[model samples]
Target: MSDQTLPKTPRDDDSVLAAEYVLGVLGAEERIALQARIDRDPDFARHVEAWENHLAGLNTAFDEVEPPAHLKDALERRLFTNIDSAPQAGLARIWNSVRFWRAGAFAATAALALLAIVTLREPPSPPATGETLLASLVTEQGNTRFVVLYDSSAQTLRASLVEGDTPAASDYELWFVPAASGGAPISLGLIGGEGEKAPHVPANLQGDFTDGATIAISLEPAGGSATGSPTGPVVAAAPVKKI
Candidate 1:
């Protein structure tokens, strides 16, 4: 807290601070303070924008992941080894170098989420007779007029929309979210908001149709998301449960 103005010194730490912010490695207090600085300082704001642009391409590229067991310790050793509890002047040094404790912040932010991850057990397979699975897709307002039934043997869901409005030039896309943590959602093509339309599950996703997996309805363009992930608002969703 020695110098809030240190980041405004020059583009050296300023640009690195921008990268740290975009990477989301700052603490809650630091983030709020830095964001305020960006709002008032146009030059610093440009640095944030530049870093955002540099990291934008990574959004659709990197998949969700769990860090390795040694990741936390390794990052701590590399980044926090030189940090000290020196006088207030030393606090300025630590504050000025934003990247120094970035790994710590990143680790702190993710540890709770990582600890909350439930171990994914291999879900029981559906019987060959095809267990009937039902999911009532509802909007945020708790509208449940959209229902989908899954046929385990067929690897398809019969979607029947009793009520829902579809925007012109938009299609309702079905996605399969696996039970395992960090798994990406897999698109199961499109479904119509009308009587009994069977949406085919891709061969890869078909195996993951066990209970605990979830099915969601997202509104997309006429064709679908250009990116492999959901790019639009999720209108309704429900967990696939065997009846």
Candidate 2:
């Protein structure tokens, strides 16, 4: 979905943006862009505060561990050392030494690792309210299966099946069969005969919020939709979104 199609908020916008940011779910490029914007936009700081408070709530689950005494002293010493450093005099000359090349290589590797972490963090679970929708696909034998999908800040999409009812003797798996597709339907994951569980949606299905994609529950072997497509009868089906 396009940004123009998304709802723009006048209040709590900053808080909402910051909350998502702190969750570490924002894409690497998007986070960098927000950082640049924060430098010039004091108004955006409100959002940062909102994000901080949101994360602060999660801190209650953990007990604080005190740092080692030397560790604290070392940190303070390093902080003072950086503050006491003299400004560099004029333009620094580039060194042709092997040590300089080694340092440059190390810095580049560190940057690549940081980017990998930022981009590879797990996706957020769906929020309980707002534009999110929760549904269930029931088998023909009258078993209820649960699933959820949510729109990202980028208006992209993701889905997961948490729980479902399978026949006493058969296995049930979920598939995302695109209406215009020629290849196999993407197998989301397995479901249980009862209870709740959230499975990760396919990354490839992100941003495809059109009306054509169909969510179907297919009976497979004891494992799941192993063929990467639905091999059994689609007992339950629904569109990607309400039309």
Question: Judged by TM-score, which candidate is best?
Answer: 1
> lDDT tens digits, residues 116-190, model 1?
343124365454687666665545443324556678876656665544444556666778877778887787766
Q: Give a tens-digit lDDT track for model 2, residues 1-243.
A: 565754567655666676677787899998998888778778786678667776787888998899889998776444222122222344123222334323423333444456446746857545544333233333333323334344433342333333333444446565666667585677666553222222345566755534335556666766665566766666565544321
Which runs in model 2 stand beyond 4 Å of their true positions? 1-131, 140-147, 151-164, 181-183, 192-198, 209-212
Tell me the number of clashing residue pairs for each predicted model: 0, 2
Inter-residue clash pairs, candidate 2: 14-47, 162-197
Per-prediction RMSD in angstroms?
A: 21.1, 26.0
lDDT of 2 at 208: 57
Top of the candidates by lDDT: 1
